[model samples]
Target: MKIKNLSLLVAMMGGAPAIALASGYHFGSQSVSAQGTAFASGAEAADASTIFYNPAGMSRLQGTQFSGGLTFVLPNSDYSDKGSTNYLKRPTGGGDGGSFAPDIVVAPSMYLTHQINDQITAGIGMFVPYGASLDYGGDWVGRYGLTKIDLMTININPSISFKLNDHHSFGFGVSAQYMNAELDKASDAVTGLRMGAAAGAFGPASSAITNLINAGAISGAGTIKIKGNDWGYGFNLGYMYTLDENTRFGIAYRSAISQKLRGSANWDFSGVNMTSAVPGRFRVQSTAG
Candidate 1:
């Protein structure tokens, strides 16, 4: 059998709470070797990446081994306004947002495996399992909906595998994942206008607020920002069966994890006080193969 050399990956992360880039924030660039075939044969366990693809396959590796690689990705995307209208039914005025997504990104991964004995193997892997980023110009029509979003995550996995016989092997592993995110957007123009109007109706004492609004200092067009970080844990199990030297099958399952991302959202419009809590609980499900 020929050992496959894994490739480095460069993957794109599209922005927002819904990770639309690839399979729920998964970059799918963990193995260059796998990428060549679009990950169809990951279960074959032809390289050290088995540490992630199917830990049970680690029992098939000989001696100590290590693999490391990086992927660079360039993403291009734009938003065009097709007659978008604001709350007042007036045309939202702005030019089409240029290519607002990041032009480039780098994703890195590493894995190591050791044979503890004839039937047992141990390994560890570090990689980015999920992430996303997006940015829109301040003048974009959708700026009030979303200006920018960023998410970053990392997973550390330690595993062990045991070969029950020549045909079957089983593996189990645990993961420690850390995630951080930030989001910002322009405040709604209509909401700002309503606040200004309310202040003006409050009589002479509200003159300062009305004056600020007219001067554009409190245009209600400021920004709202939210940021948070959290750590979560999950586990994965795998089973592999070898029908022959050239044919094998594997299955893996990773459990879901819930994280309470404690954070705050702040509105920065002049003369307005606004704040809110965010993400009381967020649950992220794992992938299966």
Candidate 2:
């Protein structure tokens, strides 16, 4: 194998999470070889990913084999001001503005399979099933909505396939996943609303508070940062039927797995504070961010 291949083998051994699903989570990626496709005959290819395809399907392949390739994924995203509410009622309606969206994103993938014997088949797969990203404009009304965002994951599945009859087969697979997340806080718009909102809730402080705010003494908007991650396990079951050399049907089921992402949101005096929070925000604010 090549250096790239070996390096990937090492990483797969680590069981990284994928970037798919809501909140930037993904389950798995596309398969590589035709044999890979044969076993995983349908959208539910998890089992046929190699020895992963119906193990029963492997009994069909006469010898050893290898399959590998890349998958190009184009992800488009948008983070707009559209409509929003200020918990503090700042009277500031977050306005629409220019975007800092990321360029088209392309992700890579691969898979490999081998036939062990009439009773069992062994195989390995390399693919990305999860990921995430962030690209907000500097002038975004919701800059505080989110910043410095990222998503990444890796999974390693070792599986087996077995044949049941002339055209029937069964396969199973187990996966281990590792995950991580990154976040950043945006600056405030106008210090007036951010600082004033504190007083609105308290009923009222004093000119001392106003003076402190005007003197920029109360401290403008504080920066908030968050981060955390988790791991999960799952399995796959699949079946395939052969109609002829060039015809067949496949069905596979993948169990659901849960990942708990834990992270703390914090405020920093030294970091960002947007110019204004937005519209719809009131006494909560006259102006904000």
Candidate 3:
């Protein structure tokens, strides 16, 4: 009974968070061996790849160890337009978006661990933590929502572990994360003109807005594009306890990080009348961190 209870306790301690900080965008498979078991072997002290799963596992490794792997992701998604609507609930008239997901994505990971002594181990890991890419063209029915988006992030983790006596080990790590993203969407000129008409923003030029709408000049008047990149920092902690040579327990936690993107927004209004355009199609830079 005591052994069974101990096993349960260790299992719970060693179970790392099944979900990542980035959730849907996170690439959870960092270690090839851990991935084979659905990443449930965080406390196994398996290899250098442990630098990503459970840094404390490095304490059990001897000498220098390195692990590397590449993963190929093939995603396919088809959007069936079963009556889509814009922000105003009006039917969005456009072609049904085909497969917007990428055909293939290659994600790679590398880790290196070195034993400084019998009681200390140090390692570093580089991997993709979050990424995505999709394109739906500018004329899609849901273009206003999102025509195209690309996001990528890289994480560099350096960790160290200390072995206390023979039964317990603890680990700490610092992470530097970098992310880049680009987003684009179609702007509804007709809707904006209507809103402006209701708010009396056009004043004496109100008739011109009506004329543009009547002439169908608002169909593809503009597109909004945003591009940004930023960096963030975080930390992680891990603990591993050994109960006999065959049983070990582990647990790890990664801190949440927030980054303010600094970039520019570009509005393209080439399809509309440039003479009457309110200089809305221009570049706006953000000084955010």
Number of the predicted model whose TM-score against the real structure is largest: 3
| Candidate topping lDDT | 3
What would the TM-scores of all predictions be?
Answer: 0.75, 0.65, 0.84
lDDT of each residue in 33-148, candidate 3, tens digit only: 88888878745878888887788889999999998888888886787889987545688788877888878887889999999999999999999987888888988887767788
Q: What would the C-alpha RMSD of candidate 2 be, to one decimal place?
A: 12.6
Residue ranges of candidate 3 with Cα displaced over 4 Å: 1-24, 217-219, 273-289
Give candidates' CA RMSD values in order.
12.7, 12.6, 13.7
Error of 3 at 44 (Å): 0.8
- Sorting all predicted structures by lDDT, with the top scorer first, yields 3, 1, 2
- Against the true structure, candidate 1 reaches a TM-score of 0.75
- Could you tell me how far off, in angstroms, the CA of residue 170 lies in candidate 3 after the best superposition? 1.1
Model 1 clash count equals: 6
Model 2 agreement with the true structure over 1-289: per-residue lDDT tens digits: 0112222211221112122223653534355544345534433333334444443354455566554455444555555554554333443244443444355444455445576767666665555676776655434455445545777766666667777666877777777665666665443423333344444522354344445445654333333355666777877777778777677677767676677666553434343222232221111101111
lDDT of 1 by residue, 35-84 (tens): 77988866777677887888898999999988777877787686667887
Alpha carbon deviation, residue 179, candidate 2 (Å): 1.8
Superposed by TM-score, candidate 2 places the C-alpha of residue 37 at a distance from the truth, in angstroms, of 11
